[model samples]
Target: MNLLAQTTNRVPWQRLTTAYGRGTDIPRLMETGQYEEIANLIEHQSTLWQATPWALLILLRELAKQKPDKVSSKEVQLYLAVASAITVDHMDSQDTVGTMNELLDEKYLWPEDEDEDELLWEEEEPPGYAKEAFFSYYYFSYLLLKDAIPIYTAIMNGNDKLAPAIRELLLLLEPEGVSE
Candidate 1:
């Protein structure tokens, strides 16, 4: 199956909502399946929308499916953009990731059309179970990339624009011989 189809078919889009509206719109652009709108849709104010991983996982799974010899520069950079978003958005433990994680786990908090401003305090104190569910899935995304380091290095070799982002990801990873 194609990456866009794989993601849409697997992830329950109706149950997911972006700040703008329902997540149904994601597929219209993703049909191209070529890293169309990561910069605009996934992160805002330096935070990944809780809904991002649905789109992200499609790209990720596609990359994970590639052999290193077949990886292209665009594909590598697309992965970099995704990984960099994860790193930059998660950069400060107390800020971006912390807040986005909190939101991802929030299963039942939606504002009425009139209460547009109420989302602030609700996010600050999500129910405990929400936090648990969010982290469980968020960390799992790293597991998906364990074998893709070579892909990252390949992108770094030819693209200087992504060096800092690549370094941030490398630092988060355990070194080859280290044990946790």
Candidate 2:
């Protein structure tokens, strides 16, 4: 399926939670290209939601289509910067993988064992769904955005005007070298 179709159909958006509440409004916002609102919904006070990474995946895919240029609006640039900042904030400290393992050990959500789509779309969500969502925030955000490193690198190399925002983004994408 195409990216657009995946954006609309890949996940149970409503069963997901955002900063404010359920992500039922997310699909409509995405369809309308309401990115600023989307940013706000995904991250708030530097806290990421279950919907953050999914929404961000779609947003970055759209951004990847654009050629880097000086003409992109401040709102677009700001949103990119904010998204990168919040994502890195988690990457720097959160032990998402470990926490997720613990959640699984506790029988929180069986994303690893069950079909994720089926688990996400269940008529009644599992009891630990909300907590799992909370703990998985950083994990999914890091996992999804890590794949967009090349896209961010290309945009950064193509346009100097976006350097600051793109630099912040790369901090998340480009791994730091460790001293032996």
What 10-residue stretch in candidate 2 is worst by lDDT? 1-10
Q: Model 1: runs farther than 4 Å from truth? A: 1-9, 33-36, 64-129, 133-138, 145-147, 154-180
Name the regions of candidate 2 deviating beyond 4 angstroms.
1-9, 70-133, 172-180
Query: For model 1, where is the 10-residue window of minimal lDDT?
Result: 88-97
Model 1 TM-score? 0.49
Residue 161 lDDT (model 1): 68
Against the true structure, whose TM-score is highest? 2
Global CA lDDT of candidate 1, please? Answer: 0.46
**Mind giving the per-residue lDDT tens digits that candidate 2 earns over 1-180?**
122223343555655566676677988987777767877888777667666666766766677787777325443553453445443335443434443224223343334333465455564755345644455666555655666666667767887877767676656454451111
Question: After aligning candidate 1 to the native by TM-score, how far in Å is the CA of 12 from where it should be?
Answer: 1.7
For residues 1-180, what per-residue lDDT tens digits would candidate 1 score against the true structure? 132223232444444544454455676756655454543555444344445666666656566555545545554444444444444223223322333234333353333232443454356643222544344333433433434566566655545766566555555544332223
